[model samples]
Structures are given as C-alpha cells and as structure tokens.
Target chain A: MTDPLLSVRNLRVTFATRQGEFQAVRGVGFDLGRERLGVVGESGSGKSMTGRAILGLVRPPGRVTADRMELEGQSILNLSERKMRRIRGSRISMVMQDPKFSLNPVMTIGDQIIEAYRLHAGGAKGQARQKALDMLAAVQIREPERVMAAYPHEMSGGMGQRIMIAMMLAPDPEILIADEPTSALDVSVRTEVLNILDRLVRDRGMGLIFISHDLNLVAQFCDRVLIMYAGRIVETLSARTLHEARHPYTQGLLNSLPRLDAPVDRLPVLPRQDSWRDGGPVGESLETDLPGGL
Target chain B: MLSLALTLLGLLLVTFIIGRVMPIDPVLKVVGDRASQAQYEAAYQAMGLDKPLVVQFFGYIGDVLTGNFGRSISTGQLVIDDIRHVFPATLELATLGTLIGVSIGVPLGVIAAARRGGIIDQVARVVALVGYSMPIFWLGLMGLLVFYGILGWVGGPGRQGIIFDGMVPSVTGLILVDSLIAGDWAAFRDAFSHIILPASLLGYFSLAYISRMTRSFMLEQLGAEYITTARVKGLSEGAVIWRHAFRNISIPLVTVIALSFGSLLEGSVLTEIIFSWPGLGQYITKSLLAGDMSAVLGGTIVVGVCFIALNLLSDLLYRVLDPRSK
Candidate 1:
C-alpha cells in the first residue's frame, strides 16, 4: 500500500469565548492517502474546523493542538506561521462553501487565478498566465479567455464554483480540503462538480478531504467515509459498505436517509441520546430501537 | 451629465439671486459712496446689471462659461484670476495635507486593524479621537506657537517668508512648483517652512477622519472570505493585506480622500484664519462681510465647480476601482 499523503492524530480545537474555553473538536484524527475521504456531518459537527485546522487557517481565539500531524511524514503541528504558509495552498489548498464570497468581487477571474499561480508557481507573468489558462481549461471551462476577464458576479453558481475549483487546483496542492464545495450549488450542478472533482483527483493522484452533510452523495462519490457526531468520528467505513456500518449514529444517519426503493411514509428523525455524545459502541441496541425494521 | 449641468446652473442662479437681494448695493460698493450717482449708473451699466433678472443671470452664465468671473470690487482683479492665483496655494496645502493623511493614515489604520484590541490599536483609536475632537483653529494656533514662536522650527504663516517675495516666479501659481521650476531650493524650503504648520494642522484633521475610515474598512476586508482564499493560496500576510486587502479598502478610501480634499478646498477656514493664510475661505469671508456680490458669487461658483468636479472624479474612480461596475 502507498504511504498516506497526510496523517493527523488526536487533534482538538478549542475556542476561548467570553464565557469559557469551549472545545469544538476533540481527539479527532484521520489518515488521508491519495484517495477521496468523505467526512459526513451536520452543522456544528467540526467537519469544516478539521479542514481549516489542517490548512492552519483558523483565526485567533480558536486554538488547535494535536499529538501528531504530518504531511508526507513531515511534522506540521510545530511549524511556524511563516513556514506553514509555504505549505498551505502550494501543498494543501481549501475550497470554501460559498464561491460567491470566496471569489474576490472586485478582481477579475484572470487576476485571481494568476495571483494564485504566481504565489507558489513563480515564473514569468506570461508563464503564470498560461498556467492559469491551462488550469481553467483543465477544470472544463468552455470559454477560458472570456471567463478569465469576467468578474465573480458575472458568473453563475456552477461557473463560479468551477472557477473556484480551478483556482484551488492551480497550485497543484497535494491535498485539497473542499468544505461543502457544492452545498450552495443546485442539485443539477452538484453531480457535475463531483464528476469533475473525481476526475481531477484520479488524474493528479491527489488526496481529497470532502466535507459535506450529504450522506447519499458521499456514499455515491467517495472511496471511504467518516461519520462524525459531536466532534467525534463515530464510524469509519468503506463507501461500498456504508449501508453495513455498525455504529448507531452511522445506522441512524443511514436510516434517516429516505430511500426511493422503500417509499417510506415519513422521514425518520435522528433520535438524540445523551450517551450517543460519548460515541461508544451501542450499535446493536439502538439498531433494534429504530422504528423501521432493518 | 445633464443633471450635473443643471445643478451647476441652479447653483449659479441661486447665488446670483442671493447676491442681488442682499441689502448692500454692489455698484456703491464698487464705485464708493463719494462717487457721483452718474458714476454708479455707469458702473452698473458697464456690468450689464441694468437688464432684467433673467437676462442678467443668462449674462452672468455667459461670462462664467467664457472663464470671466467678472471684476472683484475689493481686490479690483478678475474673479477668475483671483481664484486661479489663490486656489493653487490652498491646493498645495490641501494636497500635501491629504498626502500626509493617506500615507500615514492608511498604514496606521491597516496596522490597527490587524492588531485589533492590542496596544497599537488602542493608541491609534485614542489619537484619532483626539485629532477628530480638537478644533482646527486651536490646533493651528498651538502649532504656530510651538513651531514658530517657541522653537523657531518653521517660518511664520503666509505662502512664503518676506525674503522669498518677488524672488520665485509664479509659473504654476503654486509656490512649491514655481520655486522648483526656477531651480531655487532656498525659495522652496522657505515656502515649505511657511506652509508646514498650517498644512500639518489641516493634515491632522484629514488623518483623523481617514485613519478612522481606513481602520473600519480594513477590519471589513480582513473579515471577508477572499482574504481566506488569499491565505489558502500561500500568500504572505503582508501580501494578503497590501495586495488583496488593501485594494478592497482603497476603493472606499478614494471617496473619503476626495471628499476631504473637496472640503479642504472650501477653505480650511479656521486653518486659514489662524495662520493668516490668504485662501478662498478668507476671501469669501471678507467679501461676504463687505457685501461684494461679484466676489461672493464668483467665489461661491468657483467652490461649487470644484466640489462638483471632485464628486464626479470620485464617481469615475469607482468604475476604475471596481470591475463589477458597468
């Protein structure tokens, strides 16, 4: 087996608020090889925090600590901000939720792409521009030149998302952390974006941490899945075998997803248990507790 | 463009009407009370003020279009010529003032925003508050007392010292430029020293407003998601600020700077009065008190034109700064 591109262990993120130190992520860890790892969780589940912490992009008042975090076996936890900046986009870039806000409104698409390229790709302006254009085309943009000069507002959600993907991938980062890259996109374009992402990762042999709340999409798209609840990874399963997950949270998540084959009367709400927050193995007991027969 | 033209026309008509309705007789003010009634009649006739109000307004509009602002009753010079001469002085002062404001204020604001709630931000906020609160006249006086009377660090008020009188030729009507054009560094230094205190005082006012605006603008830009995108691209914090973030703040700062410059042109009246500097604020005030209608209207029109031009320039600048604009 190939070595993991990135490995994280016992990572925790705590925010110091006016009231007290509130821990958001606790002892969450994963190893990302050159494969798609989908982190599926609902809002406030620390999925986005995991991605941001990996990139070292978390702002002040939020603290991140880990026993071990390595990119290709090089220790990343102790690196200074200046040193970490060298690795951020050139090696591990991020795609945020909203492309409309992620893209600089005043700047042209060409300028933004060229800026990203030149930051790490350092060459002549012409070379950087050529690389940008090539990357834009690589992302399946039909009219590269026209889109290059167009501003962010001029593009649609799909086109803007494509442009964002092109920009993030331009630096040829080893790992791409896409935090809900398609949640803002409509259903029609979501699959298109997924296909593009799949193709790019396959062709480049890059690691991807696909953070999303869409369980069905993750099961359909990714190679492996990590189910998170209350800042803990409750279950890790092969996407092919996600339906066979053992954890109650995972089972609950799966049972909650409305399947077209069953045609249920109503969608089941995820029952909350105070003990579930501990994320211990209580799968079989809760499995029988579910109203629908498994 | 049509609306702009109408606004200018309306401004001129209103000022003209105000001048006509004032209790003082413009002709008597020009000819003097001792002059014969015939002399007063001739002076009014010469100005074509004997015509109907609408005709007189149209006539004034024609003269204004031709760059003739009529004769100044007090200064006895063409109103256009007075503005042309005196404006550059104020321009030189305000330009330098605004330059100081932007150069220092913008960087200070950026730093304060980046280090928000830190000692530097606290210091900047306190300084801005003090600067904004202090009256320009008191600041000007205090500056004069320390820099001029006490330390002898700079020359006393006016465009230049008596030594530079008739020495530097007026090429651009700006002493600094004309002195440089004449290759006279001594005259330039002398001119510079005389303007230093008043310009600094005016600059303090601009700096306060600009720094406060810049701080808010930087805070807004820094919080934006694009800043995160820039960071994710491995761009340095400085690059993220100066390149990505600064550009965002710059668009709004341009409007602020332009408006401040426009207000400065209306005469830093307090700065002018305290420093005994001869500019439009002092000119208009003296003319208004003496009820010199031509000087008053002409000065008002010149100031109005300047304000409109600046506003238009700022609007045009928006298109250049923001590509989202059509």
Candidate 2:
C-alpha cells in the first residue's frame, strides 16, 4: 500500500504548571490517508493539544515531544520556525473551534483569504482574489464578492466557520486539522458546516483530523475513531463499530449516552477505573485493521 | 458639530465661573489694589462683572465666539492676539515631540511586546519606567547640562541662538518653518538645535506613556486567537505581530497618541519654563503669575478646546481604522 499522508508515534505534550509537569497528551499515535479520522475525548483530554502539537502552535512553557511525527515520510517534529512555516498552511492547515476568535476582526474576509493563500502560493493579489472567490464559492457561500468584502463580525457563525474553512483550504493543504469546527454553530448549522467540510475533504482528497467531544457526531461522520482518556488513546475502532467498542472506558462512554431507540430512566454514569489512567497503547496494534488503514 | 459647539460653550462657562469665584478680583488686577473705590466700581461695571453670573457666562461665551477674549493686562494686547502669537510655537514643539514619540515608541513597544521577556523587552520596560516616573523638569535640566552646558551639542535656552534670534520674519510663528520660509538655513538649524533638546525631553516623556500603552495593547493582541490563526497560516513572526496584531491595536493606539499629544500641547509648562521657550505654556504661566485673568482664562479655554478637538480626531480615526465602528 502507498504510505499514509501523515503519521505519528509516541507523541507527548507536557505543560509545566505550579504543580509540576502535567502531561496533557501522553504517548498518542495515529496515521491518516485521505480519510476522516475523528479524535473523541472529554475536555482537557488532549484532543486539541494533539492538533496544536502537529501545527507547532503550542507556545513556550508548554512542551511537545514525539518519537516520530512525519508527513509524507519527512520528519516534521521539532522543525525550526522558518522551515515549519512553509509547511504549515501549504501542507497542513488548521481550522480552529470558533471563527469569531480565529478570524482577524479588523481585516476583510477577502483580504484574509487572499493573505492566507498568497503567503503560501505566492502570486499577485489579482490571482489571489480569484482564488479566494473560488474558495468562498467552494464552501457554498452565496455572493462570494459580498462575503469577501465583509468583515468577520458581519458574517453569521456558520458563515464565519465556512470562511475559515475556505481560508485554510485555499492553499490546498495535504491535511486539514479541524478542531471542533462546527461546535460553535447552532445545531441546524452544524450539519451544514460538517457537510461542506466533508465534501471539501473528499473532493480534495485531504486527510482530516476532526477533533471533537461529540461521540454520536464523530460515529456518523468519521471513518475511524480514537477514544482518548487522560491523554492516552484507550480505544481505536471503526466508526461503524463504535457501539461495539472493546475497551471498558469506551463501552462505559457509549452506555452513558442517552438513546431514543432504547430509552432508559436515566443514562448510566460513566464509572472510572484507576487502570484506565495508564491503559496499554491500543493505537499501535489496531492501526492497520481500519477501513482506510494502510 | 453641535456637540462640539455645546462642549466649547460649557468650557467657556466653567472658565468664566472659576475666574469669578476665585478671590483674585479682575478689577483689582486691572485697576490695582490701591485704586480708589470709585475707580474699582467703574472698571467692574465697564468689564460687565456687575451683571448676574448667568448673564456674565453668556456674555463670556458670546465674546469667545466673536474672537474677543478681552485684553491681557501683562502683554497689553488682546488675549486672542496673544494666544495667536504664542500658540503656534507650542503647536510646533508638541507636533515635533509627538512625532518623535510615535516613531520611536511604536516600534520599540512592538518589539518589546513581540520579544516579551527578552532583552529588548527588559530594556523597553526600563526606558518606559524612567520616562514615566522621572520628573520632566529634572530630565530637562540634565538634558541641558549634558547636551548644552557640558557637551555644547545643542544651543542653550530659548527658541534660537542669540545671533539668530528675531532674524527670521514671523510668518508662521514657528521659528523653524518661519526660518525656512525666509530662506534662512542658519536660523533654521539654530532653531532646530535649540528646540531639539526640549522637544526630545517632551518626546521621551510622551514616549514612556506611548510605549507602555503600545506594549500592553500589543501584548493583548498577541495573545488573541486571530494572532494564532495568522501564525498557523505560515506567515512569518514579523507579519503575524506587526501586520495582524499591530494593525488591530492601532485603533486604540490612535486614542493613546491623541491624548498624549493633547497633554503635550498644553502640559509642557515645565519644559517651556526650563528651556525658556516662549510657547503657550510659558505665556499662560506668566499670565497666571501676574494675575492676568484674561490671558490665563483664554489659554485655559484654548487648551480645553484642543483636548476636545483631539478626542474628536481620535473618534474619527477609530471609524477609519475599524470598520466595525463605522
């Protein structure tokens, strides 16, 4: 099989707090090959940290260490800032959780999209404008011209997220790390945004790292799922078999969800166990059997 | 425009009331304390001080609007004419000082914030601290001692050298510009040399505030999520900081700059005194010392109007900088 688009092994992120070193992401690993890979975890469970580590967006005082982190077989771990910048928006881009905070408010949407594209795909502004319009249209934004001239505050939450997606995808990155891109939108708008993202990723054949806490949404949207607990992946399974997850933590999480088909008086609470804190690395052994696995 | 008019009216009223309530009698100041009671009464009636306070306020506002600010007892000239002569010098000094402050302070602040906790940041902090806390009069004296007295790098006190003094015709009332207009480069250099030290002292004073504000505003912008997005877009760190973050802070920074300029325009009294510069500050200071109510009240009103105008300018800039405001 051809090599995966991106690969990682034994990724760890540590933050030095007043209470000593806190490992936010510990020994996490995965591979992506033009497919939707969902990372599901509770808040503070390292899902977002993993995405930031890949982008080298972690500020100082927070540390990221990994045995191997590669994109197309090239070591991307610990690259100098200059070298990493060329790869970032060109090869791997990120769509943050909320477009409200992610988009520069003072800048016009057109300028922002054009800036993102021109930074990586050096071209005159006229060419960048055409590219930006095309991107806005690709994200199904009506009246790309008006949207381009508009500011972030002028757009709705859904529209803002779509613009963010357009900006991130304008350079045609090999991978798009979407950190809860739809979580900020209304539920009705969430499906619409996800559909746009799904269609774009499929059409572009770009690997997607969909970081979210919505178990049911991830089960339906992603090709495979990684269930993280305490910064470590406790379960890795096909999205189709998410309900039949093997790990007790995954099973408990699934059980805790409220279901309409089989209604219960009360959803069972997810009981914790000490052993799950240092669970064996299930990610490595199960990496090859998934639907899109190499 | 209506608000501006109303604000000016209010300022005139306040100044008029303060002048009346203060125990320093304008009539006594004009006719002298030893003048006979009949002479004092005649001067008071002539000056319209015998009218009710409300009538007097409206009278004062009317006079201000019509460009009649009464006659300066000290200068023996119309207060309006005196302000016209003295104000331009202050305008020139403050404008130069503000220019110096903005150019150095903004870049320094940006660098300090961008490098936060680095050597540049530490140095910026120290500079800002010194600028903020050090007394301007003392700074001016030290500047004079080092640059003028000891080193002889700059011309000593006053607006120009003794040789060039009053050489250039008063076309704009700004010595530098007036000298240039008259094609007198020697006078211009001397004027600049004399103005430079005082202006630099004021510049250092404003720079402390501007840099400190810029650093804080930059620090806030740097931590914003959009800044992170810019970095993720593969822009260089410089682009991320200056283009995106600095651009965002510039709106509020305009207000900082405007307020600092306004303060410098009116608040350079000490600098003017130390340098013996014949700017509005010194004019107002001398008027107040000699109990010249007309000149002092007129200067106060002018300073107040300047503050309001600067605020209006900053508001206009806010709309230009941030479209959301518009």
Largest DockQ belongs to which candidate?
Answer: 2
lDDT of candidate model 2 versus the reference: 0.91
The residue-by-residue lDDT of candidate 1 on A1-294, one tens digit each, is: 555788787889999998998878887877888899999988988898989889898778889999888999998885799999999889999888888999988889999999998888889999888988998898899999999889999999988988999999998999999989999999899889889988997899999999999999898889888888888777777899888998877888889888889989988887877776775532233223223532
State the lDDT of candidate 1 residue by residue for B249-308, as single tens digits.
888998999999898988877788888788888888988876677787888888899889
lDDT per residue for candidate 2 within B58-95, as digits (tens), equals: 88778888889999999899999999988998999999
Which digits, one per residue and each the tens of the lDDT, describe model 2 over residues A1-294? 568888888999999999999999999988888899999999988999999999998878889899999999999998999999999999999999899999999999999999999998888999999999999999999999999999999999999999999999999999999998888899999999999999999998999999999999999999999999999988888899887788988888899998889999988988889999897955436445535653
Q: What DockQ do the predictions score, one after another?
A: 0.72, 0.87
Docking class of 1: medium
Clashing residue pairs in candidate 1 are none
TM-score of 2: 0.97
- When only chain A is evaluated, what TM-score does every model earn? 0.94, 0.96
Q: Estimate candidate 2's RMSD in Å.
A: 1.9
Off by over 4 Å in 2: A282-287, A290-294
